[model samples]
Structure formats: structure tokens, C-alpha cells
Target: MSTDQSQGGGFPAQQQEPPGLTEEMRPQPDHGEKSYVGHGRLEGQVALVTGGDSGIGRAVAIAYAREGADVAFTYLPEEEPDAEETANLVRNAGRTPLPMALDLCDRAACDRAVEQTVEGLGALDILVNNAGYQMARDHSLEELDDERIDRTFKTNLYALLWLSRAAVPHLRKRPGCIINNTSIQAYEPSTTLLDYAATKAAINNFTVNLAAQVGQDGIRVNAVAPGPIWTPLQPATQEPEKIEKFGDDTPLGRAGQPAEVAPAFVFLASPADASYVSGTVLGVTGGKPVF
Candidate 1:
């Protein structure tokens, strides 16, 4: 099983509503269901992954389980089926799985996610703020409405803050870490996804600053900024034309798959591997630059 697989990028035109499902995507993304052999790097740890029902979240949850971590994850109510599948994968790997149907835009829900993960899984060692939101537009200035901006920021940025704040005390005790899911769109902003891009750039700032503040307490903070990856988010949010070309802009000449990006999270969360690594962004960008 390899961590990095070239997906050959282009996809047949498809569409779905917000918070898309894994089953609906054609050529269904490989969430490391068969690939990603782990070496017990995260043994005995417990992790809370926002939006773990599918895409990078599912892949990360699967990787964490295989690495021996008990996992709890959050998803939209509409994403229940996808969440169940992710839960089954964790069980198959001999770990606990807690799936919560949640809309993370609520501050209370963010706090609850951490509390439940600790109570259910026994402890919280890794927190992956991987849930995000974005929508493609034909005219960014004309069509980007207040509601769209608010939802994008609330989901992508505000929830990250709420969750991390709630998780800090618990993490300090275990000397655990936080890994926010950032994006290539941060550095290379998309004209259409203005709100989403802004939040990602803010996340980069937040990740580094939080790492510094938490380091004294033995808590590490970092982020992973992925380039165009073939996750359900593409079809659900992007314009058809954009989805058709997808990751071709990358030097790799194709978009990446969820499986290919999971290892970066595992590496960042691994104490033996990343104990001294903090306040940095790991790029799984298919030849795109994160810096």
C-alpha cells in the first residue's frame, strides 16, 4: 500500500449539493480503504476530526485508526451514511469510532465535539480541524453575497477557533497537537472562491500563532495545505468547468486523491516523527508550492 498515488486528475462532469457524499462521486475516491499501510505511529491515541464523513477527513480518520488511534469525527446531518462507512473502517482497524452529525458553524457544537471525543474515546491527543466550505462563482464580486461569506467563514475559520480553544487544556495535559486543514487556495487564491480563500489564509496565520502560544504547555500546532484533491467538495461546490480541469494546474498535471494526502496528517501527529516540529505547514500539493 502506497501513501502517494497519482490519480490521473480529470473527472467526468458531475454535481451535488453542499456537504457531498462519497458514494455519489464517480470513480469513488480511495480514502486509503485498501492503501495506506500504517506502522503503529499513533498507537493508543485518540483524535477528533471535523468533517470526517468523507474526503480528506475520511482518509485521515482511516489512517489514524490504522495507526492505532481511537477516533471521533463530525459531519453534516445529510452526511450520515458517509459517516457510518468511516466508522466501519475504523472498527475494521480495531479502534473506536464516534461519528457526530453536526453543523460546525455553531460555537456550541465545536465545544461539544471536543468534550464528547474526550468522554467517548477516553482522551484527546490529536485534533484535526479538517472541515471546510467553498462555492465557485462566475463573477466573484457580483455574486459573492453576505450569506455565502458568513457561512464560509463560520465553517472554515470560526469553528477552527472554537474547537482549538476547547481542546487546548486537554491537549496540554497529554502534550498533544492540533492540525488545521488549510489549502493551496490560501497562497494562490481563486478568484471565484474569495471567502474560502480568505479563511484559509487566516488559518495559516492562526496555526502558526497558536503553535507559539501552546508550545509552552507542551502542545504542538500545525497545518496541512493540500492542493487540488479529488474530494466530494469539488463536485459539490466548484463550477463544472473548474471541476473538469481540476488539478491540471499543478505541476503534477493532475489533481490528487484523498489517500495521497492522509500521510501528512499521520506524520504531523506522530510523536516520534514530529515531536519537535510545530508552527509549520506541510504541503501535500501535487508539486504546488505551499510557501
Candidate 2:
């Protein structure tokens, strides 16, 4: 990372194919490889993070393990390398790591992921719906076809519903919680990301409604709406030109690192810290307004 780019928003203009890999990114993303210190906020808990193979999911998985929680994360079959790296990080934190290759588009796969987490880890305390998809610079609505639209909804919204439905029963047993990964696009809605933005808005609605429906059962539901964090999602989804200034528009003047967002997941998953926090969107988006 250059000092000039260290300022946050002045990225050196980069790009990658859809579903980019962390290792290939310029200025490798900082997933708290050494700096995140945990104080047992989630001691003895178990977590299932979708997209845990890289980016924000990897950060959350690493943080959860350090905080004394066993972690089970899902990734695409092609993301095995990333998954292995994340598993190593979790193990180094003195916690168990169950990395599974899965396709979230399949409803059955979503159900099985939840089952595997509880069955393999002994219990389920947290579920992080962090996996998503988006195609950048699809300027015209006409350019957005049925396949892209379906894929966007299935990956971002449908899988969330499927996973949440499957995990809710287990969560009710432990009185656990669900944390969703939403985006600033939900409220801001860039024309280029029409479908992605719509799904995020739907996630926000689902989070609030589900929180209300399940509150009496002692299972909380919430979301994190990040503005512009430098992750695989950016290079994978945005145009090369756009990638150069990826998060420069934020008030903070730069994109946030994955490590910076991990703490928010920890805080929300911690009963000691957020017992009364539910149906809320925690913004980690530099300076963008989530509300």
C-alpha cells in the first residue's frame, strides 16, 4: 500500500474478473492478519459466516475465532485456497474452523450449511449472511437481463432467506442471533447496481421484520450496511476506472479495510455488548449515511 493511497480513497485503479481472489489484489486486503485483539466477547460460541473464504467474511471469521468462537464458513468450490488460509487463521486463534465449499444459490445447500454448523460445531450462536453478487457499470436497465437479475437476487437475497429460515430453529434453541451484510447501495441505489441495490434494500426490510417476529423468542436479527470497504467484491464488480477511486466519495476520503469492519460484527454478536441491539443497521461505511 502506498502512502498516497493510504489516505483511504485514492486507490491505484484496479480490476479483476467476477468473484475476485484476495491474494491477487493489489495492496492485499488487511484481514487483521496480526492486529485484531479479542477479549473473549463471544467465548465458547459457534458461528457460520457465508462467503467466509475471503474479504469481510474472512475478517469476521478470524475475529470470531480470536474472540473464542468456533467458526464454520462457506465458499465457492473455486475459493478453496482462500478457505484454507482462513481456516489457518482461525486455528491460530485457538478455535475450530470448518470451511465448506458451497453454492448458496441452492436452497438445500443453504439448509445444509446451517445444519453442518450446528452439528459439526456442537452449537450455533451466530449466523452472518455476508455472501453477495453484483455486476458493475450495467448503466442501462436494458443491459440488465433476466439471468443477471435472477443471479443477483438468488445470491444476495434468496440465500439469505433460505439460510435464515434453516438457522432460525437452531437459533431459537440457543436464543442465538442473525447478522446480515447489507450495503450503502440499499439506500443510495447507484444506477449501475440496480439489482444489487434493490436486494440490499430488501435485506434491510427483512432484518427489521424478522427481528420483530423473533424478538419474543430471544433471537435477534440485525444488519451491517457498509459504504465502501476495499474487498474482492469491488475489483470483481466494478469497472477498472471505477476501481481506482472506489471509495473516494466517502466522507472519510478512503475505503475501509476488512479488519476495520470485523469489530462491528464482534460487537453485534456479543451478548454483553449488544443484548438490546436488534433490527438495527450498523454502518461501517467510512462516512456514508445508512439511515
Candidate 3:
């Protein structure tokens, strides 16, 4: 599926690719440029969202910014342009944006991202552990290489652990919240994405346990498990044939947009709507069975 269809020829066809930047997407995902209306749900708050340069992360950043929060995000080395565009959208929403590039798999880098976000944004009120990667392998566990398994765990699980640990102290001080991005695969495993499913399951467990530990400190921990959304990751991770029919089997006939999953983050981060909500997983998987 070429993501380069022409829109009306005036504004250019926006890219709709998953896991990639809004700029590169054929029909760009909505950033609520003029659509999303905010009423100060998160005013005066500060948020740090990993992978905020694109996809669901970008949607959350824009929503947070619209709600009057300063946002900081981390992206991979090669994703600078998309990262900047996300920042610009935040600024356009009348909020501050701090764009940083770092490899979350590196413990030191994760710590640095936390520290820099706190220093740059003044205070961190919300932390969104949204960065992740996966590879589809048809091999069984025995045939899976140790290296691939290790990498998957490192990126999807360990990175969240390290980043959350680093952010906890700062979060504790402000009674902040943490929102982890999990996957529907955590509940229903896909044969091809064995390692990815395992990591997501770990994330689900981590969110529950961490919420219990942090509840006393007034820190909330939660997760969102999204089945399949249109993002750059689809094309980058799956085969073209799979990409063409993405989300076709879901209860919703078509795939979801990034905008649809982002409001869950906004509600979880905002005290107004989720003061009593923690240790819960919001399933945004297009009416898929979560239980």
C-alpha cells in the first residue's frame, strides 16, 4: 500500500502510515489542529512521553498540550524531523515542547531523559512510557534466537522498567502519574510475535504491581492496550500484505487512527477524570475482546 495518495492537491495528501511521522504518512493522522477543543483539563502540568514523535504518542502529546500541559518527548536518533514536528504542534497548541533523542534501551540514556525532562519542564507530572518495537518471527520458542528475544525484552520491557524507576523519585515529589503503553497481544498471543507478546504481558504485570507500590505516595500507574492502530510501525514491522488488510478482522471493520487511542492517555493523566483510576488497563483495540 503506497501511502502517497493525493488529497485535494492544495494541502497535499497526508501520510497515514503507522509508527512513522505524521508528515510522512499518506493521509496524516489528526493532531486536533483545529478539531480537538481543550478546557484546561491538564493545565499547568508537565508530561514526558516517549515515542511522542509519531503515532499514538504524537496524538497524546498534542492532546496534553491542548489541555495546557508542557510536554517533553524522546525519539530515536533518525526520527529527528518527526520529533520536531511533534514539538511544533505542541507549541502551536500554546504549550511548551521539549524534544529529545535518546535510545531508551540504554539505562543511562533513559535516566538522562528523565532528568532532562524534569530540568527542562520544571516539574514532571505525567510520564508516558510509550516507546516500543517488535519483530514477527514464525519460529517456535526453541527456534527463536536468544539475541532477538533479548532485544525484544530490552526494548519493550526493560526500557519501561528503567525509565519508570528513574522517574519515580521526581514523580513521587509531585504526586505524578505513569501510563505505560501495553498491547492486546498481552492477553491474546500472536504466534508470529512471541517475544513481543511476552514483553507486553510483563508490562501489564508491571503496571499493576507498580500502581500498588505507588498508590500510597499518591502516584497513579496505569496502562493502555491497543490492538492495532494505523501507524508507521505497521509497514516497518509487518509484511505488505498484512499491512493492506490491517485491522480487517477486528470488530471495527477498519483500523483505528492515532487520535482514537490518545484520549485514553489524556484521561489517565488528568486528575479531573481519573483521580480514582489506577492499576487499570484501558483497552483501545477497536472493540476487541480484552478479557
RMSD of each: 1.1, 2.1, 4.9
Worst 10 residues of 1 by lDDT: 1-10
Model 3: per-residue lDDT, tens digit, 1-291? 012222221222232323455555555555455566677999999999999998888888988999999999999978888888898999999999999999887899999999999899899999999998876624477767888778778889999999999999999998999999999999888888989999999999999999999899999999999987777676666665666567776776666777778888988998979999999999998778777
For model 1, residues 1-291, the per-residue Cα lDDT tens digits are 574454666788888988788888987998899887889999999999999999999999999999999999999998989999999999999999999988899999999999999988889999999999998844657788888888999999999999999999999899899999999999999888788889999999999999989899999899999999889999998777777788888898998989988999999999999999999999999888998
Q: Each candidate's TM vs. the true structure? A: 0.98, 0.97, 0.90
What global local distance difference test value does model 2 have? 0.91
Best by lDDT: 1
> Model 2 Cα displacement at 73 (Å)?
0.4
Evaluate all candidate structures by whole-model CA lDDT and list the values in order.
0.92, 0.91, 0.83
Model 3 reaches what TM-score against the true structure? 0.90
Better of 1 and 3 by lDDT: 1
Name the regions of candidate 1 deviating beyond 4 angstroms: 3-6
Q: Give the candidate number with the greatest TM-score.
A: 1
Candidate 2 per-residue lDDT over residues 162-254, each given as its tens digit: 999999999999889999999999988999998999999999999999999999999989999988887888888888889888788888888
